[model samples]
Target: MSIFGKFHVPSSAFALHETLTAVPEMAIEIERVVVTDEVLTPYFWISGVSPSAFETAARDDQTIQQIKKLDEFADSALYRAEWTAQVQSVLYAYTEIEAVILEATGTDQRWELRIRFDDRDQLGAFQDYCERHRIAFSLQQLTQLSQPKTGGQYGLTPKQQEALVAAWEAGYFETPKEAALTDVADELGITQQSLSKRLQRANQALIGNTLVVSAEYAAPDAPDPDLKH
Candidate 1:
């Protein structure tokens, strides 16, 4: 299964606006306006923006009244009032960022989250928010590769075997492939340096066993000649 979600944010909130703008092509539009708890004061109903132009206007800080070329329903006076309410609500800090939870498939779960901020100050706040909530976050893009020989292989642990097999398939011998040791490490949930060391030890054992078996087989030809004589 895969899941996707869109998070709504108000343009008046500079912090959120900056964050949303950094994401390509995504836009926020006012959906409804409301007043929340007394302590929180103002609140807004917002959803993703459509028609692209509306998004452009909102990001450019154009007044809702100035946005003349809106969709039929969107251009109406009632809609303009709603949009104004949304902007005002955000200015007063009535809305806060709720979590955007997207249920993803095993493969999609591996997707690396790439995020950017307007500047260092916003970056610091975002980092703090993620850390406080213990969110597993990364800016790098993520991909997943399947391994065929992963089930019940050697006496090695799942992580150890995954590293070993990935190394083998990638050709540790004559020439290296485009495969990343770090990818294997990340998939197996281990450190790259540690996985490398484990692969090395595994290689040594495999080589030593093959050499020993070949030597024992070579002794058979000489012994068989005595029996023929």
Candidate 2:
């Protein structure tokens, strides 16, 4: 199992907020920002360009109509811009670096940026920046789902467990009926034949017997290698 960390850092960076106000047609309230700064430095460097470029690009009024066009042409481009900068800032603090994940969210004067890293030092630098900037920050450790203990006493394979979860979500047991078997199968990317087999196994293991096993089983193996795609 891999140990992962989550950091929530608040920044008063007005650059993003100012950009939103320029386009009246586009109304976006940030629900959250997700980012990975696995290998980023602490300093951000813009190509010999003046800081005003950022300020001007966001506050420019003449681009209002053009910005509306952008919404049509590049729906997710603005969001991508926001995500890239927020991630790059922490990752490229002093130099170019690869990031694990970088996410940003919020609106107006309050924005939360999250960065994740495998190494502790990168996370430390981000924490330091948050303290120096008076940004509220939090750290959460992500437990690996592949770990053995998560199975709890059922001794079900992870795939079987996941299929059972999908059944519940699909409302297979619901009164009015919910998601179909094919729906769940499609979501899991498995043949209906496979999904059914796993779901049945999970049910029998979890609910069939009166006496339940108290011991939790760990994963037999790590995640599938093909899932990276």
Candidate 3:
């Protein structure tokens, strides 16, 4: 069975953390990360204001200084680097465990990673790796993804169920809007785009299931006046 795990690790123990911590106004949402040899290539979005400081920080900060190249795209930035031994350890752990990160985001305080693994063994190996690294890791949620969605969460998948519930509790869909998409996404341990897609799908599923049958033309058994045999 596949395992979906939401985890947190301190910024101090991770790369790109310094750059984020330097700009509290900035929220970084990772689009993708590739680990190879001793290098990491990460593509991410920088939310908030347009940033000039990113280039400067990449040159100045000890962690970010390791970056070999930085490319700015229309919607996101990408960095290529030979990471530190510490960062290597973290990435290597994923390899040994057959795991992949589905989503990751970081603020000044910490990094949240939503990772998926092929099975329990991979998870156990990853857990041990965290313990060995002395990384202060917190597992927020874990579910077996191979199983069918149950619990009558309105036919929502586990991640969708969690995201919808989190958004509602955080008031993302409420009157006057108690919370913004950023806040709701942050609370749900996902990026804003990911959260947007999840909420969209959830809303679509709910509306389709609840209201489709009520349409005047929806009933299958009713005689169709427009149809002639």
Candidate 4:
């Protein structure tokens, strides 16, 4: 069974470190990190930055091989960039990453990442990779998944979990509508659209982890799939 583990990689190991170093006040939350066209494109939602300052910081930062703004919205913007070959090697070395979230803000430079692996061998290989490259990293948390896709809380992001709980308690899923999205959004100090998106994403993750397993076990037909992509 795969074990769930949370690890911390110091700021020096991330390509964004240089940008963060340049703009100490800026903070980023990773929405996704994907490998495309032989490059790692990390989509981040940046906060505590004005568009002008963000642009200036990214432009001035040279540690990252390349960077480009992908999209922008009110109070948040998305960015994509490529890391060095040594950084790329660590990501490719691991077959699966359960989750990766940016932790710390306001001059505290560090990234708390949660990842999953098949066994100790895989985790050890990654540690060796980090050591060989001299990347400062440490394991923070570890837990055993009950089954594939059955990790505690189904691996929901903290925001997702909190939003899910609020949604349930507020009766957002009720037929009579005991509460509305706007109410939850107001309480959470987020926009309605943001609340909706968070709830939807949370639902998807929960369904993927819990219901998918239930259906797979209950299905009578050969390889019956309950999930829709």
Candidate 5:
């Protein structure tokens, strides 16, 4: 049985510490990571700062070997970063245990990471490893991925479920809208942007699980009757 864990690590203890500190409002969402030849390369999305500003800050960070902007949008940009080999942090620990990173987001204040471990033992080992290396992390939530239940909660993680329920109860989905986005975010003890992201993911999961069907399960298309031999 796999287990999902959410943790919070202070920015000072994680990668991109300098860059995030310089751009305090910047938010990062790691898209994927690749480790090869003892070097870790991560592709991530960055928001709240211009590409030049982010690049300048990243260039000065000792932990980063190189940074490249892959794509840019009005408010956010995608970047790839190669971490220096000498920099060992929680990310290295994750790769050591072969844990799957479900979601990883960071800010100047802290980093929120959701990781999936093979089982209870794997999760325990990860915790132990962090302790041995004095890598400080606060465990936010731990959930066992059990058999799916056909209930009101489809396949949402605990945080997502909480956000969705809170939003609904706050009348966020009502025609008149009883509560403001800030109000809901404050109630959930998170930033408005974080709340919005969570709600979006929750809605997507709900629709995908309930309304959408796999291609194999969907009805087959009618055969074409065109006169082509």
Candidate 6:
């Protein structure tokens, strides 16, 4: 069985920790990652700061080899970063254990990550790798799936799944007003508040599981011994 895990690590335990600390208000969402020969190249989206400010802060981060801005928006920018191969951060640990990063977002204080591993042994190996490297993390959630394809539902509870489906069918997610919240609640035989909460949780689960798992970069056959802590 595959395991889905969610956890948090202080900024000090991952790549770009210094950059995140420097820009306390900045938030980062990892868009994609490619790991090869212990080197990690990740594309990320940054908001709440300007590109120049982020570049300046990144200049002092020891984990980064290079960073290039790919696009810019009014409040957010996209960037591609190459991490130093020898840096033993949690990202490296993910590569070591062959874990797929489902979602990773960072703030100055900490990073919240959701990852899927092949099995319990792979998950255990990830934890062991973190311990060996002295990388501290807080485990938030753990779920086991009998098969991988079953993750389409993202571990939503029966009631949550039902509420979400009903709401969608009622057009509660439409851009223009197709259905009102109260109407969806009535259809589900639940209060508006309960329906809202269920929808919120369901949406979060969908995002966390579906985002950033595509376009995996091929890794080498064996881990790099030199990169081991």
What is the C-alpha local distance difference test score of each model?
0.34, 0.42, 0.60, 0.59, 0.71, 0.70
Which ranges of candidate 6 are over 4 A from the true structure? Answer: 146-167, 170-229
Question: Which structure is stronger by lDDT: 3 or 4?
Answer: 3
Query: In TM-score terms, which candidate is top?
Result: 6
**Candidate 5, 31-95: lDDT as tens digits:** 45666665677777777778888888888898786788776766667777787754565455556
> Could you tell me every candidate's TM-score relative to the true structure?
0.23, 0.36, 0.57, 0.65, 0.64, 0.67
lDDT of 2 by residue, 150-193 (tens): 44345454466688788898897798778888889899997676
Question: Where is model 5 poorest over a 10-residue stretch in terms of lDDT?
Answer: 218-227
Q: Write model 1 residue lDDT over 1-70, tens digit each, in one string.
A: 1112222222333223432444423322222223334221111112233434434544544223233322
Which candidate ranks first by lDDT, i.e. highest?
5
Q: By the lDDT metric, which is better: model 1 or model 4?
A: 4
Clashing pairs in 4: none
After TM-score superposition, what is the CA distance of residue 105 in candidate 6 from its true location, in Å?
1.3
lDDT of 4 by residue, 49-82 (tens): 7767877777755445566776666655656666
Ranking by TM-score: 6, 4, 5, 3, 2, 1
Model 1: how far residue 31 lies from native, Å: 61
Cα-lDDT of candidate 5: 0.71
- List ranges where model 4 is wrong by over 4 Å: 63-66, 86-108, 150-162, 179-197, 200-229
Superposed on all Cα atoms, model 5 deviates from the true structure by an RMSD in Å of 12.1
